[model samples]
Target chain A: MNPFPASDYIVAAFFLFCIATTVGGAFVAILTARVIRSVCGLMICCVGLAGLYFFLNSPFLALMEILIYIGAVCVTIVFAVMLAEPDEPPSGQNHGPGVLWGVVALVVSAAICWGLSQLSLRGPWVAPAARVNDGSIKAIGVSLLTTYSMAFELISLVLLVAIVGALVIARTGRTKP
Target chain B: MSLPEPFRLLSFLVGVMAFVGFNAAYLVWVERKSAARFQRRPGPTEVGYAGLLQPIADGIKLLSKQLIVPPGADRILFMVAPLMVMIPAMISLVVLPFGGSLMARDINVGLLMMFAFGSINVMSIMLSGWSSRNKYAIISAARIVSQDVAYEIPMLLVVITLLMITGTMNLNEIVQQQEGWFWHWNLFRLNVNPLMPLTFLIFFTCMLAEINRAPFDMAEAESELVAGAFTEYAGMGFGVFFVAEYANIVVGCSFATVLFLGGWQSPFGLWSGVWWFLLKMYALVFTVIWVRWTFPRTQFYNLLNLSWQLLIPASLFTLILVAAMMKFL
Candidate 1:
């Protein structure tokens, strides 16, 4: 008898789809001509990342990935796009410098990607000796307050400073120097 | 439904979707009649009986309209945004605890999942408005981003306070905590603490803002922005947004019902089931419609001031107060 059912194949197919979506969305994000379309590409990539996170068994992180990236970050980028007229330069005029920059960028990205892939694939892949936490929301909350409390407080402080800095910068151009 | 199993979840999703569809249609009808009554004028009495079938007429009209793609608009994003909105609005309904056994997914982070998925609705609006290539739509989108950012803080604080009081994030667990008597509902936790009412009020207003209902509906102010982000959409492109808005309202009110009101729990310890859940949800929804017609649209600055100045401070205070109560009491 078949140990694995048709449902298992369906799930595997869905997982493959998620991988395709993530890679395709990222490719579109970098390759797109229109700045706004790039934002859409980023959003699609985020959604795919959510799927990946779901597969990783942290549905909380999956949802938060959608919430913070697509919801807050992309929307703010959209606002900036609206306020500041932006469009890709379309490989304007230069043949030599442009190609040079393109090669440099490509080389950098490829190296990083290859390095990370190797690091992941070459892992020992052994289970941890002991479990510190269950990775539930409760576990996350407890660790955030207990073990990671300092970092959590620092993050909040950073966000507060960023808001203040934004306001200060926004207010500067209006007042007479 | 337990969701380690996929086959059962697939069937349950199908049923839940049908229920959501019926809820959206019925809500549109209710909203129309409620608005007519508030205005002291007759509603669509010609369609079926007492305007019972007006939503069908509206649906037919929307469906029949031409789907025109404006030349300047981003073709793909314009097409995709409506579906984007419809997806998350429906997904959020999955985790909402309707009754003892009426939920689809009872994950521990139920309320957080709702909030997380709900944010995508705002993102979709941003995309649609940005893609439309209209100044009004762009402006509306910008306004919405700011409004969402401001209102979300107070709402999160309210949710956090509730999480502390109830000592759980699961919607089913939260609802179970409020069982037996109506007074046991978290809204009137006045016996243990005085901050619950304020938190509830904060939650209600934030819920209205989150779903883009009036008087907080300045982003879609019809007269000012010519229907705002929806100015360029036509036919079912617009229809999808309309359906999604009503669906979001239902989801928001359902959330409020579960969080504050005694969800599916009886007032007098009598009949209980999904019916009581439906009753509480609809009653909250009716109040949403009632408030929409009664209040005038708020000014944009005034709206920000209300959220940032009033609601934010009040909610933070409530959060602190509740924490203290939990510590000492």
Candidate 2:
């Protein structure tokens, strides 16, 4: 898989950088008090994830990740943050239930993380024996329009409904001026 | 002798940077001169011959000035925002097929990569505004976000139509499909889709809106928002934003040329090369400048309405029509 053996070090360095960015961004996203900064951190995480996808030989998915996540999703979140309160509620005010909820959240997250790690470590991670297609853009397009057409159409329909719902919700109570 | 791989890569990167820098500097001069002509005045005649050295003068001035951070502004984000704007525009340049052999990197998903980076431009503007901590800037940021979001759909729909027609997301391939005479261009491919011209118009309108040119210059509505999202930026910070804006115009026009007009294809069907691509791209850029001086800034809501109510529907119809045409005929 190493097309240029000499450049493997450079590739590895880039992979490390991506991993670091993803982890650092996730931490910043969770720990940051400013919602806007958190959104930026999420954007950083998405970019690193896109790089990882590129490493996985799926440049299409990688570009789509950046296109959809950092471009659309995170920007929309920042827009919402701009419209709404842009900061998290300050901590240290709540006493008991907040602490209890924190513990519950920590436990839940830990359990889920442990379970996922275990699953990944133990699961059958074999590659497919043969591929139906070369996984090119054309193949993706064909499969999308043929084999996955129903699912694709359904997803789009769902998105359309969600958009209409958002418009309806946002438009409520605005008087005709 | 051929250069080593690293040296070749470095040279390409340097060339791209220089290209982006030159365009950023001179497009401002072109815009100012064209804008002045539109208003019946001589523009920037002082610095050099017809102000040919104006951008250099402006660059030196910006470089010498102080970089001021507004008090209470988020310093890190504020400083990074300008870079954010510039870097994505620069990255998108790597994928632009300037000519048959004149691109830096010819990725298979070049079109998508260009667009993916284009989306980041909106995010950078949003960040710049939000970090400024100014009420006016925040308001402008909101407007920019919605404007971009609305316009991107129609633009992408138009692109999807082109993709379906060409069956490739490669920018070079898209251009190759439009090779030969002017009529073979996507803009005039009436036999494939009768609404090709209308589709081109939709794309052009969206490109204008996406790049925040007039009448879609809500991001910097100086009359209302006082330089809008970038009010807090000073000196080089402000200069970088403007350069990035011009660079984006270049990128957008180039994308429009590649997607619609016959990129690098000589209209006469004779000699063809990067010069034709440059000519077409600059022509579109001139149109953008012409538009800015011709039209007053549109009312913000009207801009959004123009996208949602007009361009989106029009582009979507073209998309479906093209799809049906391809499937049946």
Off by over 4 Å in 2: A1-5, A86-93, A127-132, A146-154, A157-161, A171-177, B1-4
lDDT of 1 by residue, B180-294 (tens): 7788888988855697887888999998998899999977999899988999999989988888888898899899989999788887667767899888888889999999999
Candidate 2 reference-contact recovery? 0.59
What tens digits encode model 1's per-residue C-alpha lDDT throughout A1-177? Answer: 223357779888999888888988898899887888888888888888899888877777788898789877887787788678745356656788889999999999999999999988997786433444555556888989999999999999999999999999999899985
Clashing pairs in 1: none
On TM-score, the candidate that comes out on top is 2
* lDDT (Cα, tens digit) per residue for candidate 2, span B113-147: 99999999999998999899899999989999999
RMSD of 2: 2.4
What is the alpha-carbon lDDT of model 1 when measured against the actual structure?
Answer: 0.85
